[model samples]
Target: MHPSTPGSTDQHVLHSAAQWLSAGSPVWLATVVATYGSSPRPVGSLLAWSADFGMAGSLSGGCVEEDLIARLRAGQVDGGQPQLLLFGDNAAEQARYRLPCGGHLQILLQRLGKDDLAGIQQMLAWLSSRTPFVREVSLHASGQRLTLLQHDSPQTCRLTSEYFIQPFQPAYQLLIVGAGEVARHLAALAQPAGFAVTICDHREEFLQGFDAPGAELRCAMPDTLISQRFADSHSAIVALAHDPRLDDMAMLDAFDTRAFYIGAMGSLATSAKRRERLTGLGVSSTQLQRLHAPIGLDIGSKTPYEIALSVLAHLLAERPQRS
Candidate 1:
């Protein structure tokens, strides 16, 4: 993550790496190919770096990167071949690396040259189109190599003797309709969780009242934004306007998209009334079922901050399942 942004996405890392390659900098891409037990970073976590281009992602969010960099500089972990480095295997190793208790991480570290730039750009192009793809790393007698394959759906990140495979897609986005304190708080909280947030409000005056760092603000109709941008499997739509004129209209277009999560901010009673109103407006039973009124978990949220917390939690829980 940069100092200006709340968090970094894998797509951002890939783009940064590509930029470094274009500059003729020697770069290396690190991926957490396997995690066992209480790992800090999940499998498929990515980090791309160059001695001159700087670093873009995090594998452990701890001392692993620093240690690996030191090792690489000292000529300890280099042979110009893709290698799997294991960390936190035992108590001594755990203490040395500051890994979580019982946590083990297996990292696939590869050195990339100009030859890989074409494939990297192709992957970036696929991501730009919001397409999912599989990055297959194969172990061979000479060294580990990679291939990029287009995929319709995301697959589990797994490693075997012959290959380390991971599915990748575009960054997950959150389109929030109507701007208010809750919207402000949600945008702030969701960004750190790796959700790129966009807030849209038709109310020009109301739109002036909301502000959050790294959140894209739009003073336009919801249909144009939802249909054009948020109509993807990697999107989550939330109507927080609390105004039926805005929220319901947003809902009408949202249900037609492939957004994985669709919700509205309201109480139980208000949600029931909302369901009735949407049904009367010709929302199908299936579409209505997809809507999560009284959005967020039953976390007993009271303040705007707490409500945003609950909503982000719900999104994080359902993120992998749906998207």
Candidate 2:
């Protein structure tokens, strides 16, 4: 599956591939097209393959993916023009694929090759630069070829693709305003959920207090740090510190870009005060609307860990609604 966070899709594919290859099995990748009735994996979930076996990201909890892997190893994927794989559903009879339960899913498995490896590499590069890509792959009885297309507005180029289209967006980036305990907690929680998290603070003392795994630490001025590095819609900016100087300028810079979610951590009183200060500094109402002050949802979070969960939950809640 493609993640909005940078590099996670390619990372998962490569990781799964390595795992399969290490076990001396040829691998195939199965992608989900549609889902119904409480499916475990969503539309874009992925399953990796090797000749012997495979591991799926979230496809079918080892039941379906394992079965698919066995079929792939036995050269069973050599049938059907547009193969239809069903899981958790037993309603209709398609001559191609079927599932026992009504949790219907559609999957297409293509054998991996050198060209596929190159395509994954290219997708990884675009993700690293925070670029949105809509990848179209042409599949044959043998292999697949990919073309990378940029994601733009509705008025953008029209696709006349005869091949299948797989859209990939880099994950939302986290710009942690303060590198404190709460920031560390948030950053650590975000990575596996496929968020690329970065912590920014000028104070070495505060920055040194963090040691979150998979988070990028930046001990630089927040404004310049964000301006140089973050400038895309696939980012979420947050001001976590209780300091105006540290959070204000960086958030202002974030306003100039297409960052999807902008938030701040504080109480209702603190948020009101912060709002007044920001208005005094000329932050417009529209820009202010982008801010999620009194950050996180009404989860009654008190401790750092609980606050972190609230913050991430709010992020997920807002993601599907983002423009």
Candidate 3:
């Protein structure tokens, strides 16, 4: 995950749960049951609790979670039946809790078994596939209670019972064509930002100098190189090599794919020339416009490092705002 954007607490919950299981201990899964007005965590926000590690993730704002953590550490927890935790709004006791925005929230804390961990792993598999998923957990209390929740859905709720959410996508990928200086810099900068970066070039010299950590280096033909790599909405393609034959082939291949960003490196004259060549290759003007020619943002970048920073700034500009 990017330092700028830490991963969702959902992943942390699963991680904590797995940690507890590995250490031969039991863990509890805490999820927001309902929300009123403007709770910090919407319904479905998860917090995993274990005897040893306390809590990972949050069920509500700081106050409620601190209370939950203390309760979790105490060890004699209830089971089989889900409890409702209310904060802020309506109830006098809730107002004492002072949940931000005066909103009310409900939470369900359930002890997790080994089988429950397996189910969480299953959800992670689905998330890796980049497909949306909704899970209905069957909790047998006095009888059997069925609760349905979507990971990454948009629906929110007000009761401590059930709701929906859209799980954040972690598959944003960066395809860097031409393993040159700019490619190296970009690979280094983009990797720490949670982008799965891949650097491609046929030149052995370029590959030899490619030392960016967490980036994949490929010495393959650009046209067919991108075929097996990108598969979803979070994919981006960039051509840092000014070589027309190399960059053009990759750009052409990417144009047919679902990559959200496609950029090429060149000056104004060079970009115009490349455009003419592309038009000659039967690429329409509209298609040609998709190329972010002159690659990075116009930041008056002089060095390769500065240019890479400019490119990354442009890419980050496309990200949605955080809540």
Among all candidates shown, the one with the greatest lDDT: 1
Local distance difference test scores for all models = 0.82, 0.68, 0.69
> Estimated TM-score per prediction?
0.89, 0.82, 0.71
Note the clash tally of each candidate: 0, 14, 6
**Cα misplacement distance, residue 20 of candidate 2 (Å):** 8.0
Model 1 lDDT tens row, 208-307:
7567899999999899999999998779999999999899999999999988899999999999999999999999999998898899999999999999
Clashing pairs in 3: 151-167, 152-165, 152-166, 152-167, 153-165, 153-166
The true-versus-predicted C-alpha distance at residue 265 of model 2, in Å, is: 1.6
Q: What are the RMSDs of all candidates, in order?
A: 3.9, 4.5, 5.7
Model 2 TM-score (2 dp): 0.82
Collision pairs in model 1: none
Give one digit per residue, the lDDT tens place, for model 2 in 1-323.
22322246656775666556555555566767566655655555666656455364646555676667667657777633335566655644311233435566767666665445555566656756656666544544444444454444221212232444566655667788887778989998998776888988888998765687888888888777777676666678888887878777777788887777888888999888888988898889989998898899889999989999999998888764322
Compared with the true structure, model 1 gives a TM-score of 0.89
The TM-score ranking, best first, is 1, 2, 3
Candidate 1 or 3, higher TM-score?
1
C-alpha lDDT of residue 138 in model 2:
52
* Deviation in Å, model 1, residue 88 alpha carbon: 1.7
